[model samples]
Each structure stands twice: as C-alpha cells, then as structure tokens.
Target: MKLWDYDAFILDLDGTLIDSGKYHAQAFADAVLAQSGYRLKPYEHHEFFGKHSIWFAEDLNERYGLSLDPQEVLKHKRERVQEIFVAELFAGAQAFLEFWCGKKTMALATNSPLEFVEPALRDAQIFNCFDVITTASDVKRRKPDPEIIEITAERLDVEPEHTLVFEDQLIGIKAARAAGAKVIAVDNGQPVNYPVDVAVHTWNDLLKLSELHRWNPN
Candidate 1:
C-alpha cells in the first residue's frame, strides 16, 4: 500500500518540504570558506546536508586542516543560513503544505536545529501546519539514527508501521525504515543508494496522490 494510506504524515524540512536545500548548502559553503579559506565542492555539500550542522563544522575543520572550534563554526554557518532562508521559500513548499494540512496528522522532523527550523518555518508561513515539530536539538542523535523518528511516532501517538515519513536523503530514509515506518524519498537531485518505496521528483507528486483511492492521508 502507498504511504498516504497511513493515518499521519511526517515531512522532512530541507529538500523534501522546501526548495531551499541548495541555499542551505551555499550558506554553509560560504561560511566554511570565509572562516577556513577553502571551498566545499557540490558533492561535499550533498554529503553534509540532512545532518547536524555541528558535524558539518567538525568535518570542515578536519577536511580543510583548520583547528577551529566546531560549535563556534556551526554558529557562524547557522547565522548565514537563517539570513538566506528569511528571503526565500523552498520551491513548491507552500503547495505541499496546503495539500497536506489537516488531511493527516502532520508534523515536521528534521536534523536542523530549532533556531533554524522555527525562523524558516515562520518566514515560509508554515510554522503552525505541523502538529508536532522535532529537531536534532531535541534528540540525542540525528538521522541514520532512529531515535528522532521513533520519538516523533510516540509523540504523535501513532504506530510506527502506520506512519509515513517523507525524506530527501538516504540517511533519513534509513532512519525511518529502522524505526519500522514506511518512507517515501523525495529526490531533490541527491541520489539514494538504497531502495526507497517511492521516489518523487517534485512536491507535486504528493499533491497528485490526492487522486489515488488508497491515499486518504486524512
């Protein structure tokens, strides 16, 4: 059965729900280069997205041969990201939210920090669509680790098997699967090595499911 058959939906924040993943990557790259005097390749950016920002900072320090404080570095990167997000909405993001609101018990689950998620969602006018909002800050571990997904399911009061997780990265897909939930991958140009039950090219695909009989997300 398709995921929309579930009682509730959980959406990933970055590339899955918003078109601003690249903006995030660029902001990080800009922060890294400005602080470390090195450039991050596109592939490297893909590798870092959908994970915690501190890890990105630590990775940058190690990769670029800099001896910087990871927390401080992450703070700088997050500041830049917040600035960029304030002015732009991820492409088709609003449409997806409009399609899913109240149709299902929906919420947002992301590896992004609350500072970043809250401001961005507010700016995008989607701060309230989510019945539950979870971030890496609230969890001990990030995606590829099932803690967040499992925690969200518990908070939403839904069985894991009955929850549908929408994610853009393979790591996140793995997390949802490990949590015993069905996952639909959103291909925001990043490739997934493992199998995903559904791979959508655009948020429009979620909207298209409105026509499917099995997809009564409500």
Candidate 2:
C-alpha cells in the first residue's frame, strides 16, 4: 500500500512529531537521582521511552535494587518535566499535520500522560490537528501493551488494520503492530532497528513520499 493509502494516521508524541525526548530523559534522570541517589547510565533514558512515569520508576527500582516509591518519582519527574520541557516540533511535522488536517482521520496517541501531552501539543500549535487524542491517563496500560493504540484507533472510529501508526521507539511500534496497525518508523537521528512497513528519517521525507503516491487530501 502507498504511504497515504491508510484511512487514519496515528502519531506518537515524543521523538516522532516533537523533539522532547532529551528533556523527558533528563527529567527522568533527575527524578531518579533525587529519589534514589543513583544516576541513570548514559542512554538508559532511551529504554524508558514509550512508557508511563510510574512504570519507568518501578523499572528503575527493579534495575537498581532501590526502595524508591514509584509515586514519588513520578511526581518529581512530572514537576521537572513541566519546568524544563519546551516543545519543538520536528522538521515538516507541522506541515505534514496541516496537510492532512481535514484530509484524514488522525489521532495523537502517546504513553505520556495528559498533563504532559496537552501542553506540548498546545505549545507545538498542533493540538487541533488530531481528531482524537489518547494519552497514558486515558488507558490502564501504555505502549507495548497495545491498549493505548487500540483505544486511539477506536476513538478515531477507524479499524486498526486501516490505520497507519508513526512511531520512533520500538515499544510504540510493538504496540501499534499488536493493535493490528501498520507501522512507520520515524527516525529522529537514532534509527529504529525494528522491522516496519515503512521508515522515514523525517516528516519531510514522509511528505515527499506521500506526494509521490499521488494521494491528494482534496
């Protein structure tokens, strides 16, 4: 199928449309350090992508053998994220979204909580682009569980098999696949090694590819 052949488009927030992964990682690192006095190893933050803060905190506890409260770490990380995070959309992300605004059924699905997701979308000025928005708070389980993606597809009133998910992390891709959606790995410098139906380095590449498919939004 062509890039624009899908009935709906589901996009992951961090690392996919926005470049906030570093901020998220830093916030998590700070939270872990403040709570457990253990610094996260370099690139350890990448492992936490596409997961809820509580899940990440629990994982930290298990990995480091620390008796840290997941709730406390989650709270601290949220506060740090609010103070430090600055939404910066990936190149051509706004354009791609704008181009498909009224042309396709779209949803923003992320493991990030609504507290973080809302402001980021608003800051990026693409909050209104999606027909539906699904966040961690909206589901009992996050990415890699398929609940988030499933719910997003349902909310968009589209079948998972007819939806196309754009993700950066393997967990999100796994969830999308599990939900029965085709996956497009959006590489933001760090390339995804997982198998996907399509892979593009940036939103610009996707835009060009879509144009080549001759699928007009009109």
lDDT of each: 0.77, 0.85
Kindly provide the TM-score of model 1 when superposed on the true structure, using C-alpha atoms: 0.85
Where model 1 places Cα greater than 4 Å from the true spot, the runs are: 60-64, 87-91, 191-198, 214-218
lDDT measured at residue 180 in model 2 versus the true structure, 0 to 100 = 92
Q: For residues 1-218, could you state the per-residue lDDT of candidate 1 as single tens digits?
A: 66456878888887777666777878877777877778888788877666556677787677777766767667777788877764354566677777768777987899888877888788778888999999988999888899999989889999988998888888788899899998887766666564734555556665566545444545
The prediction achieving the highest lDDT against the true structure is: 2
Give the Å shift of residue 14 in candidate 1. Answer: 1.0
Could you tell me every candidate's TM-score relative to the true structure? 0.85, 0.90
Error of 1 at 164 (Å): 0.4
